[model samples]
Target: MSNPLRLVLFDVDGTLVDSQGSIVSAMTASFSALSLDAPSRDAILSIVGLSLPQAMQNLAPQQSVANQTRLVDEYKQAYHAQRLAQGAASSPLYPGARDVLEELHAQPETLLGVATGKSQRGLDALVEAHGLERFFITRQVADHHPSKPHPSMIQAALSETGVAEQHAVMIGDTRFDMDMAAAAGIASIGVSWGYHDVSALNSATAVIEDFAQLSPALAQLWDK
Candidate 1:
C-alpha cells in the first residue's frame, strides 16, 4: 500500500519567499499615505500570515472599520505600484527553496499546494515570476477563500486534491499556519527561515531551519 501521507501544503510569503522587507515597506508606505503610525518592523513581522484586512486590524486596532479598509486599500495600491515599478523584484526564494520543491515534486505519491494570505493576482505573479508554478497543483489565495486560522482554505486544498487530513502535512512559518493546520486536524511542519522566530513555531510537529533539511525531516514524519 502507498504511504498515507500524500499531500504537502505550503504557506507562500515567508515560507517559500523572503518577502518580509517588501511587505514591511509597503505597509509603512500605506501608513504614511494615511498619515497613520506605521507599525514597527517587529510588529508587522509578527502578523505575517494573516489576511490583509486582518493584518491591518491587528496593526491599527484603534482605527474604525472604515479606516482599516482605507489602510488595506492604500497598502495594496502602494504594494502594487512598487511591484510594477521594480518589476516585482521583491522576495526571492530562500536558499534551496527551489531544490526542495523540485525534490518534493519528484515523489510520485506526493502532491503540492499552497495556502497563502496573498491575493490570487499577487500570488500568481510571484509564482510565475519565480518559475515555481510547476510545483503547486492548487493554490488557495486569501481573497479566494477564508483567511488563515480558519480551516476553509486548507479544506479547499484537501478537497480539490483528494488528500485526507491525516495523510497530509501543512508547512509554514507562522503560528497562524500551525493553528490552521491543527484546526483542520492535520500535521504541521514549520520553517524557522520565515518571519516568525523559532520559538513562535515551536508548537509545530517539526521545525526546519532551512529548505535543505526539509526532505529528511519529511522522511522522518512517515518513519514515525
Candidate 2:
C-alpha cells in the first residue's frame, strides 16, 4: 500500500446519496411556511451541493436578505424534523456507493473522509444511520469552515488526516466540488451519476460514470 493515496475526500449529497425527493419536499415545506413559491423539484435538485444559505439565494434571489434568512431557518427545521422520522430512508445511497467505499477503505494507505455542506449534527446522523461512520476517518461539515469553492474544509480534512494536498483527491458530483479541489491544488474526480452532468464536471481531472469506475480512476491518478 506504499505510494497509495493518502486521503480521499467525498461530497455527501449527490455523490453518495440521492436525497433529491426529500430535499425538494423540505424546500417546499419551508416555502409554504413563508408563503413563498416553492422551487420546482428540478430546480431544487440543481443546487444540491450548496450550503443552505447559498441554496436559498439561488432559489429566491428576489427575496430580501431578511426573508431569505427566515426561509432558510424554516427549511433547516423542517428538513431535520422530517429526517428524524424517516432516518436514512429519505437519503438512500446510490447503487454501489457502499461497496465502493468499502473497497476504498480496504486500502491501507488511503484515509476516507467527507467534506459536505451538511451541519456536523446532520452529517453525523446520516453517517450513523447508514452505518457509514466506520468508513470515514475524518469529516468536514459546513459549520467547520466557510462554504464550498473555499478550500478550508478540504484543508481541514487533510490536516486532520495528516494527508498532504498532493497525496489527496476529491470525489464529488458537482462543479463546486471540482472547483474547491482545484483551489486546493488537489486532483478531483467527478461522477456523472450525481446532480451535475458531464459538461459541468469538465474541469475535473477525471470523470467517472459510477462507483465501479472509481478504483481505476484512482489508479490513473497514481500513474500521474
Model 2: lDDT to the true structure: 0.89
lDDT of each prediction vs. the true structure? 0.88, 0.89
- Model 2 misses residue 146 by how many Å? 1.4
Off by over 4 Å in 2: none
- Clashing residue pairs, candidate 2? none
**Candidate 2 lDDT by residue in tens digits, 107-202:** 888899999988888899999989997899999988767778798888888888888888899999999899999999899999998887779888
Candidates' RMSD to native: 1.2, 1.4
Q: On residues 1-224, what C-alpha lDDT tens digit does candidate 1 reach at each position?
A: 76664889999889998888789999999899889889999999998889999998899999999989999999898878877776546877888988889998999889999999999888988888888878999899899777788988899999999988877889999999998999898889999888888887766999988888888988888677
Q: Which candidate is the best by lDDT?
A: 2
C-alpha displacement of 222 in model 2, angstroms? 1.2
Worst 10 residues of 1 by lDDT: 82-91
| Per-residue lDDT value at 52 in model 2 | 84
**In model 1, which regions exceed 4 Å deviation?**
none
